[model samples]
Target: MKKIQLFIFAILLSSTSVFAQSDATKKADKHFAKFQFVDAIEAYNKLIEKGEGNAYIYSRLAEANYNIFSTVESEKWYAKAIEAGASEPEMLFKYSEMLKANGKYEASNVQMDKFASMRPADDRAVMYKANPEYLSKILDKGKKFNVQSLDLNSNMSDFGGTLQDGKLYITSSRNASRKNYGWNEEPFLDIYEYTVAEDGSYQAENLLDGKINTKYHEGIVSFTPDGKTMFFSRESFFENIYEKDSVSNTKYSVLHLFKAKKGSNGFSEVEALPINSQNYSIKNPTISQDGSIIYFASDMPGGFGKFDIYKATLDANGNVGTPVNMGQKVNTEGQEMFPYVSSNNTLYFSSTGHLGLGGMDVFYTKEIDGKLAPIRNVGIPINSNGDDFAFRMNEETGEGFVSSNREGGKGSDDIYAIKKLQPLCDVLIVGTVLDEKTGKPVSGALTTLVDANGNVLASKPANTDGKVEYIVECDTPTELKVTMEGYESNKVAVKGSNEEEVAVTVNLKPIEEIITPEQVVLNPIYFDFDKSNITARAAFELDNLVQVMNKYPDMVIQATSHTDFRGSKQYNQGLSERRAQTTIQYVISKGIDASRISASGRGETEPAVDCKPCTDQEHELNRRSQFFITSGGPKK
Candidate 1:
C-alpha cells in the first residue's frame, strides 16, 4: 500500500548498515536506497541464504518491516536482530517506537531506557530520563476526566466532531451509497451534521451540502464564530489534481485546505488555500476564535515530523498568511494531527509521536509567559490505547468531547462525552440556600454563577436541603445567583482562592413581590476577617442589592462600610473606606449604574454589635457593610 511504501522509505533513510559488506550486501543497500524495499528484502534474504548475514541485515530488516507497520514480522525481525547482538542505539529506539505502536508500552519503555542510557544527549532520550515515570503520571491523570461513548456512532467509522450553532458536524464513513477507499477498505469520509438537542442528544442531519462533501473524502472541518466562514480538508482528486508516481504506477492524492463562505443558500464561494501543494498536504483545519488564525496538521515540507501542527494568520477579508510549524516543543518526528483550540486558548491535539498509553493520544499545551509549557497528555478516560483524536471542550461547563476507536464502542472510532472530574480551579464552594425568616430549605431555587468577565459560568437547580455547589478559578471574582419565586433573587459574590472548599450559606429573605415603606432591610454585607477584599459570603449577600438596582435603575443606594475592634480608630476608618469602595465597585460591575450607588466608611466608632470584650463571632458580625435607600424609596 502507499502507506506501507512511504513508511518504508522513511525507515530506509534512517536505517544503518554498520558491518562489513560484500557484493550481495552492496546490492541490497542499493535496493534499499532506491526505495525498492521488497527487492532489498529479497536481496538481504539471499545473503542470509548464503550464510553471510550479520546483525546489520536483521536490524535493517526489522526497520523496514516496522516502518511499513508490519507488527508481527517487525517484532520477529527485531528479536532476531537483538539475539544477533545488535548494538546500535537507533535500533533500540525504533524498537521502542514499534512496541509502543503495537501497544506494548512496558516493553517500549524498557527499550527506551536502554536507548536513553546509550545516547543521553538525544532529545527524546533526555526527555525520557528527565521524567522516567511519565507513563504512570499519564495513567493517573486520565482518571481526572471521565468519558462516555455517544449513541450517535454507527457500525462504520464515525469520528471528528466540531460544534457550531448547536450543530455537531463530524466526518464518517457510514454512507452505504459511497464507494470504498482502497487504502482502508472503508467508505470515503463525508461530513455529517447532527442537531444537538437542549438535553444534549444528537440527531443526525444531512450532509452540509454537495459542494463540501463530495464523492472523494472530506475530512474534519472548522467554522468561525458566525458559522459563515469555513475551512476544511478535501481530497486532491476532487479537483482532479494528484501526483502520479510513474515507477510505482500509483497516483498520490494530496489533501488540501479549502476555504468556503456561507451565503443565504448554502456554502459557496469555495476556493483552495494558496499554501496547498501537490507534494505536501495541509489538512485538518481548526479555525481559532475571531477567524483570524487557523491551526492545522500538515506534512508541508519544512515540518519537524510526518504531520506537524501549524498555524496561519487570516485577516478580516480572509487573506491568508504563511503557515508556521508549531515547533519541536509540540511536534516530534512522527504524526501529529487534529488540533483544537478551546475557548480558553488551550491547545488540544492528538499525536502518535508523543509517549502515550498507546496509539494516538490526546494532549494539551498552553503558552505561559510566551513560552509553551510541556505538552500534557489530557489523561485517561479521554485517551485510550486506541487512536483518540479530535478533542474539544466547552470551558464554561468543563464538559468536553472527543473521538476514539477504543474497544467496546458502538462503532469504529465513536464520539465520546468527556466530563471534567477535576475542577477548573482549586476553589470550591459548597453550601445551602434557605429562607432567612423560617430557616426552611428553599427547594427548586435556581442558581447561576458569573465569572469576572460577567459571563454566566454555570447554572443549576438547588437540590433537597437547598444544597448548591460550584467550582471556580483562584483569584477570580464569581457571582453566584439564587432565586426562588417568593424570595428576593440574590447573588453570592466570592473571590476565589486555593482554599479547597469554602462553605457558603445563602439565607434568602421571603419578601412580598413589592417593596414596603421602611428602609428595606438586607442581610449584612460581610467582609473577610481583617481584609477589605470581598469575601465569598459577602458576594452572596451583596448580589441581592445588585438585583434591586437592576430592577429599579432609578433608585439610589448608599453602602456604609464598618470594621470591628481589632484595629485603631484611624486605621479602621481607612480600611472601612477601602471596603466600601470595593463593595460599590462590586455592585457596579454587575451592570448596575455606578452613579446610583455611593459608599461611606463608618469606622469601629459605630459597631453593629457594640459589645465590649467581644467574642470572635461578635467581631465578625461587626465587620459589615450596611445599605440604605438614598432616593426612590417605597411608594406612600
Candidate 2:
C-alpha cells in the first residue's frame, strides 16, 4: 500500500510541473503578442527559474530584450539561446544587427557572413558585411556631452524663438488678463514679439488678437524662409465613434498642421493643411527655406519607432505628398519627435533612444546626398539629464535656444539661450635665423605674413639674436614667408581659422654661391633628378632671389646649367639648356622681371665639385646648375 501511494505522489508532482511550464509559456506568448516585451521577459525568466525553459524560451527572451533596445542584455540571451541549440537564420541576422548597432564591426561581419552563406546569398547580409557604417564609427568618437542650465528667466514656458529683422519672435504660455479658458487644463501658448537691444536686453509684446491660441496644446511654431507664412501645430480632441458601449466619450487627440498668411493685418485666418489627418498624429511642421519640403513629427504606421520624423514634399499645386519615414538610424525604438530642420539640411530633433543625460535630449543629424549621418548630441548646457527639447537656432547668428527642466529653473520648463564663445587665434611663430654652415645667428632676417591671396598683412625683422617673433592675428587661413640673405627662404601655409594657436619651426636651407677671385660665389639652382618641374620648394627658393633682386633694383644674373658626363655631349648640352630655361621660367613666375635672368648652357665645361678621374658617384656630383650675379648686386 505504501509503494502504491508513493507512485501516485510522484505522478501528481510530475503533472504539476508540466502544468506550470505550460502556463508560463502561454503567459509569455500573450505578453509578447500585446507588445509587452518587458512583461514577456519576466514570464520567460520565471520559466527559466523553474528549469523548464528550452532553446525556444531562451530565443524568445533574446527577441524581447532586443525589441526593448537592451542591446547588451539581448547579446547575453542570444548567446545562451545559441548554446541551447537555437540556430535559426533570423536569429543569426538579429544577433549580427545587434552587434553592428553596438559598434562590434568585426564580430558583426563574422556573424553576417555566416548568415549570408546559410541563407544562400542574402543580399542584405552580404552588403551589410561588405559596406558597414564605418563613417558612423568615426563620428562616435569624443562624443562626451553635458548640459547646464542658463540664467534665462521667464515665468512661463517659452520656446520657438527666431531672429527676424534684428528682433526675436518668441512664443510664451504666459497669458495675462486674457480670457481664462484653460486649454486642456493648461495655459494657452501664444506668439510674442521681442526686440533684442544692443545691450542684450529683451522687451517683449504679444502679437495678434490672441486668436492663434486655442484651448488646446498649440506650440512648436516656425515661419517660412520669407517670413510670409507661419506654420504651427494645433491640437484638437475628437470623440471616437467605434466604442458604442462606452458611457464616457473616449476623446482622441490629433495634432494638425496649420498655416497663417502674413499680410497687413499681421497674420490672416489659420487654415488646416491639405494633408489628411484622420489616421495619423502629425505635428511640429517645419518647412524648408525653398518652401518645397515640410518636415514634421508623427506616429504614423511604417515608422521605425514611436513618433518618428517624416518629410513631405509640396507639389506644384501646394498639396503635400505621402510622407516618408526618416529611417531606422534617425528613429530608434524609443520616441524620436520634436523635429527642427534647418535650412542647411541639418535635422535637429528630440530623442529618448540615444544615451542621454535624462528624458528626451536634443540631437542633430546632417543629411548629405540623401543619406542621414549619425545623430550627434548637441552637448551640455543645451541638453541635460532632465527633459530638454524644442531646439531652435537662428540662421543669421549661430545663437541657439533650447527648453529645459534642469535645476534652478523658475518653472517646469524654461527657454534658455546658448551663447557661443568666439574662437581666438593666439598663435605665435618663433624661430632663430641662423647661418647655414656655422649655425650662427643671422640677424635682420625679414619675416612677412601673407594671406592666401598673397597680400602682405604684417612684417617684422629678426632681433639681435637672429630670433624673430611676430604676434600675427589669423582669424582665417593664411601663409607666412621668412627670408634672409645668403639663405634659402621658407614659406609655410597653416590652417589656423579654427585653432587657438599654432607654433612652427622654420629651418631655411643655405643658399649656394660661387666663390670667384673677386670674392663672388655662383648661386646654384638644384633640380630633382631627371625632372625639370618646379615644385613649391623651388618656388620658395626663387621668392628669396626675387626679394634680393627687388632690394638691389638693378641686378642681373646669368643662369647657367651644366650636366655630368654620363651621356653624349650634344644630349648633355640640350638637357643643360632646358634646365637653365626652367630656372629662368620659375624666377619669372614669381613676378620678377624675365629680362633680369639670362639663361646659358655650359654642358660639361665647368665642375664646381670636380669629378673627373673619379667614380660614377663622384661623376654624378658634377651635374649641377649655378646663377652668376653679373651686375648691380653687392655681397654682404
Best by lDDT: 1
- Report the lDDT of model 2 for residue 295: 84
Error of 1 at 148 (Å): 1.0
Each model's total of backbone clashes: 6, 12
Error of 1 at 428 (Å): 17
The lowest-lDDT stretch of 10 consecutive residues in candidate 1 is 1-10
Model 2: per-residue lDDT, tens digit, 427-491? 44455666656777777888777655565656767778776554443353566677876666766
Once model 1 is optimally superposed onto the true structure by TM-score, how far is the C-alpha of residue 457 displaced, in angstroms? 32
Q: For candidate 2, what is the TM-score? A: 0.44
Q: In order, what lDDT does every prediction score?
A: 0.74, 0.61
Model 1 scores a C-alpha lDDT of: 0.74
Deviation (Å) of 429 in candidate 1? 22
- What's the true lDDT of residue 445 in model 2? 81
- The sequence of per-residue lDDT tens digits that candidate 1 reaches over residues 124-223 is 6767876677788677543667788878888877777788888888888898889966433567789988899888898867777888888888878898
